[model samples]
Target: MAIIGILGTPYNTVERSPFWWNKVSYTRQSFIDVFQELGHTVIVLPVDKTENIKNYLPLVDKIVLTGGADVSPYLYGEEPHAQLGTTDPIRDRFELAAIKAALEANKPILGVCRGLQLLNVYFGGTLYQDLSLTSSQIKH
Candidate 1:
């Protein structure tokens, strides 16, 4: 079975023993289901300290960046407009490092939703300030 590294959704945390995790992906479970259906092993990686991504990246054959949060507008070089959504700065840094690590390691990389935006930014590209206001009119 191909070992695939699936990034985990970052969640809000609670203050106590019953600390809670926030939901960060629309397709995390779905990806797991589909991957298992295809007979592959899925390894989930949650947000780790910025310096530790390399510890996990090398153990997998491929990297999959799942969707969640708003990509910080600053990342793509734009100021945050009123329409900008929630942002996860920690996850942003981690994923950026992960993607770069993936490239240096020469592993296959798959990105979804915000992941797509991150990839674009990492490659010296910019994002559409507003998808609906851009050339395409499809609702996300």
Candidate 2:
């Protein structure tokens, strides 16, 4: 079975939670179930545990960057827009590290939702931090 490294999303601890805000990185159970059902093992690449990201590169056949908070616009050399809402810089750093390691190792990577945005910026692409910042007629 192929091992899929899923980059975990970090979040603020909810009310009554014990974990510190932005200290936990996790993938949803549904993601784990779906991958396991398909006979692939899922490993969570935690945002707060990026120190060992390079070591993780050799263990998985593919990397899965899941949906999460908006990526930091600073990563793309742009200042954050007032409407940028929330962003997890910790998660950004973690995923970028993972992406670098994955490319150097020749491992395939998949991006979902916000993950796709970050991947684009990582590869010399830019994003309109907010749709309002763009001149496109379409609005979100």
Candidate 3:
């Protein structure tokens, strides 16, 4: 069975005692279920700044960039637009580094939504801050 590494998103929670807690989350259950159904093992990779992702690369056969927040505009040398949604710079940095390491190791990548955007930016492409900014009649 292929071992798949899935990147997670970050979220915050407030305790009943007025204390705040931050956590890394992977909300998409379908990703895990579908992969398991297809006979692959799923591993959720949390947002970790201390761990060396390269060390984990040898354990996973493929990487899946799950859907999440908009990528930071700074990565592509642009300023954030007024309509741009929330971004996680920490996640962006981590994923970029992970992607690079995975590519160097010849690991296959599967990107969904924001993951796709991140891949584009990593390869020297740009993103439209907001789909509405475009004059196209089609709505996103």
Candidate 4:
């Protein structure tokens, strides 16, 4: 059976400003169940580690980059923006390492929301702030 490695998102508190609290990584029971129904195995990977990533990368056929925080702009050569939200530098480094490994290994990667933003930044792209004010005049 093909194994799909799913990256887990961090547990954050909305009340705490820039909270970087406890993070739990696991392939949700429902998610795993769904994959089993499809005849594949769902493998969960911690998005907070460099070593665990290396150990899991070789075992999976595909990589999943889940959405969470902002990718430090420094990774793409820019200072932080005013509207930028909280980010995890350590997590950024770990995920970046995983991304590079996935690319080198020629494994398919699936990114969601913030994950997509990270992937874009990883590939030398930029993000827009206040889309309505900068690009369009749509109201909130």
Candidate 5:
């Protein structure tokens, strides 16, 4: 069975008890479900634990970047457009490093939605920031 590493997003929880807690999480069940159905083991890697990613690389057969926040425009040398939503620099940094490691290790890398965009940007490609701003008639 192939071992897979799935990147997680940061989340914050609002508790009714007058305090809120911040969390690092991966919400999509399909990523794990599909992989498990295929007889592979899934490992959810939190962004905060990036420093230890290298230690886990040899143990995983592949790295999967699941859907999450936008890639910070700053990574591609552009200012945030008015339509840009909140971006996580920490996640960006970790994922980019993870991608490089995966490449060097000759392991396969899979990317969903936002994950796809990040892969593009990492290879010197640019994003629309907001698809609606484009002149195309198609709506996303």
Candidate 6:
């Protein structure tokens, strides 16, 4: 059986668990469920220590990038835009490094939501806004 490594989204909250366990890292159960439905063991991939990503890659046959906060604009060389939503820089660091390591180690990766954008940006592509300033319905 192959092990599936799913990247987790880290966030801080005051609810549930002990007070000291506020910072949480997780992915939607439904997202991980699909792999389990296919008989693969699902495991949350750790990106807390990006430098050690290569070491972890060998343990998983495939990598899954789950959805979460917006991709930090700074990552793509652009200043923050008002339209951009909340982002986690710490999560970005690990995921980016994880992607690089996955590719170098010949492991396959699947991206969801912001994860897809990361894959695009990593290959020198930029995010596109179909609406123009004048055409955009939302106020600046």
lDDT of 2 by residue, 16-133 (tens): 6888453677889998999999999999976755678978778889999998788888888889888887988778888898888889889999998787888999998988877887
Order of models, best lDDT first = 3, 2, 5, 1, 6, 4
lDDT of 6 at 126: 75
Which stretch of 10 consecutive residues in model 4 shows the poorest summed lDDT?
19-28
The top-ranked prediction according to lDDT is: 3
* lDDT (C-alpha, whole model) for all candidates: 0.82, 0.85, 0.86, 0.76, 0.84, 0.80
lDDT of candidate 3? Answer: 0.86
**Colliding pairs, model 3:** none
Per-candidate TM-score against the hidden true structure: 0.86, 0.86, 0.90, 0.76, 0.90, 0.84
Q: Model 5, which residues run further than 4 Å from truth?
A: 15-19
Regions of model 3 farther than 4 Å from truth: 14-22
How far off is residue 43 in model 6, in Å?
A: 0.8
lDDT of 6 by residue, 1-140 (tens): 67999987886676565545566677888977888998999888765878877777888998998877778878778887777677888888898999998898888999987889889988888764322424548542
Ranking 1 against 6 by lDDT, winner: 1
- Least well predicted 10-residue stretch by lDDT in candidate 1: 17-26
Report clashes for each candidate as comma-separated counts: 2, 0, 0, 0, 0, 0
Q: Per-residue lDDT for 17-126 in model 3, tens only? A: 33356464665899999999999999888776735787777889999997778999999999999999989888898889889989999999999999999999999999
Error of 2 at 9 (Å): 1.0
Please, what are the lDDT tens digits per residue for candidate 4 over residues 93-139?
A: 88878889999999988887777888998899977643533766766
Model 6 gets an lDDT of 0.80
| 42 Cα displacement, candidate 3 (Å) | 0.4
* Model with the higher lDDT, candidate 4 or 6: 6
For residue 70, model 6's alpha carbon misses the true position, in angstroms, by: 0.7
RMSD of each: 3.0, 2.3, 2.3, 4.1, 2.2, 3.6
